[model samples]
Every structure is written in structure tokens, then in C-alpha cells.
Target: MNGVLFDSFQHNSWATKVLLKVCSQLSAEQLATTAVGSYGNIIATFNHIILSDARYLHHLSGNAPEWLLNRDLSNDFAVLEARADEAANNWQQFFTQPVDGEQLTILVSGDYEIHAGALIAQALHHSNIHREQICAILTSLGIEPPDIQPWAYAHETGRGRDLPSEQ
Candidate 1:
């Protein structure tokens, strides 16, 4: 289960990078353009993704991430990308160490107790949904969003080729 979770995190990070690469091609105005049915615009959605990941990291690590707190959504693309990279690294590091999935409890709104693994899974799913929303926004803007499928990430990272042949 830990291995699967770790792989999913890697996939999420890969997809984020691909999306950011496509976002890099757009002008500031295009990145900030409002799209219906999205959290805000491309940049705002990206910021939400980053900050949410940071919050998850804080929950997992038990240390609040000061840098991610109180951030404005209007940050430039480069800054957001850098912050995303940092958040991804934090998640990767957490997965690298031994995680007591059953022992870690996340306090939800200071009332409910939830497993850390569940929260991580929720974060992963949430990110994917937001990524799709970003893709839709990009499409509406006449820009083709980059491919962010897990298979594409596996192929790009040489993991797909690593599987044994069925022959």
C-alpha cells in the first residue's frame, strides 16, 4: 500500500510538471484569464494545488509550513512552480521514510480523527480533479494542455519499459 501511494505521488508530481511546462508557454494574462467552472484561473488553480499539498505535508510532518501560509494567489508563474517543486519534494521525502500509516491520525477541523493515509489519498485525488479542471480551462482558452496521464508519466520516466513482458 505504501509503495502504491508513493508511486501515485510521483505520478502526481510528474503530471504537475507537465502542466506547468505548458503553462510556461502562456503569457501572464492568459495564465490569469478567468474560466468558468474553475476555482479561478490557471494560476489560481495552480496555487490551490500547491498550497493544498503543502497543507498535507504539514499534516504528515506535524510541522507547519510557514512559507506556504498566507500566500497570495496572484504570484508569478515561476514562483508558483518553485513552490510546487518544494512541496513535491517534501511529500517524496515523507514517503521515503518509514510511515506508520495506522498510527498517524489527522485531526479534521479539530473535531474528527482520520487516518493519515486517507488524507493523503484524498489529497492525491483532489489534485487530479483540479488538474483536469485546469486542462478544461486551458482547452476553453484555445490552448492544448499537456498530457498528464499516469501512463505518460511512467513512459516518460522509463518505468513503463521496466515491466516484464507477458510473452
Candidate 2:
């Protein structure tokens, strides 16, 4: 894997952990609160964000398995977290294997194709944007989000801190 892609995976994992921390801070009652009424509450928005990104990531990689299809966030944190872990693992495994790094076609939609690296980049970038939203939700709820920057973790734990900064 390229250095950039590897860094992306690390960052993605870090961001994911931080989001989980934010979610962990919520109470069952607070988790369902809709601060703005129209924003669909914290749980729903977080659920949609995770599921939508996973769906698009899978679709772009030509691996849109039914198991990874849309899901309800209200189900349970365990289920949603499991699915997220699976999605992240799938991406990680794919990254572990060597790709041409040159170019490869992926199913963008009905008969559409996009470069693999570009698609992966899109997925990572898009998720990070939503992750920030999740962090904001945490702050609004009076919960602090972990510092996901590489330097923070490095400065805190040296090298063996944790695989994902969230942990």
C-alpha cells in the first residue's frame, strides 16, 4: 500500500474510535435526543452516516454485498458497531493486498466505473467529514471528542498507544 493510503487507514481508524467515544458518552435517553428537531437526533444521523458511507464504499469497490445494505441505527449499538467494524476490516484487508496503484475500474453505479484509489479516497474523505459532525454532536452533548490527529496519539502514547485513536 502507498504511504498516503496507509495513513488514511490509520486516520480512519482513529476517527472511528473517537466517534465511538462520543457515542459511549451518551445515555440511552440522550442518544435519542433530537436537539434541532429536524436533524433526526444523534443516533439516527450517526447510523445513516455509517451505513451510507459503507454502502457507497462497498458499491464503489464492486462488493456491494446484501449483508452491508442499509440498516436502521435504532437497532442497537452492538449491531451497528459490528457492521462498522466489518466495513473497516474489509477496507483494511483490501488495502493490505497489493493493487496496481496504477488504475483499476470499479462499479460506480449502473455500468459506471471509477478508479479504485480515487474511490477509496472518496470514502475516507467523506467519512472524515461525517466524523467531524459526530464529534460536534458530542460537544453539543457535553462530551469531549478524542484528539484524532496522529501527533496527539504519538505524543501521548509514543508508538504502542492503540491501533485506533478512539481506543
Question: Highest TM-score, which number?
Answer: 1
Q: CA lDDT of each candidate? A: 0.80, 0.64
Worst 10 residues of 2 by lDDT: 65-74
lDDT of 1 by residue, 8-125 (tens): 8889888887898888888888877876777888888888998888887787787545666665554676877777788888888788777876765755346667677788888898
Scored against the true structure, residue 49 in model 1 reaches a CA lDDT of 92
Off by over 4 Å in 1: 72-74, 162-167
Inter-residue clash pairs, candidate 1? none
How many clashes (backbone N, Cα, C below 3 Å) per candidate? 0, 1
List TM-scores for all candidates, in order.
Answer: 0.86, 0.71
Q: Model 2: clashing residue pairs?
A: 17-166
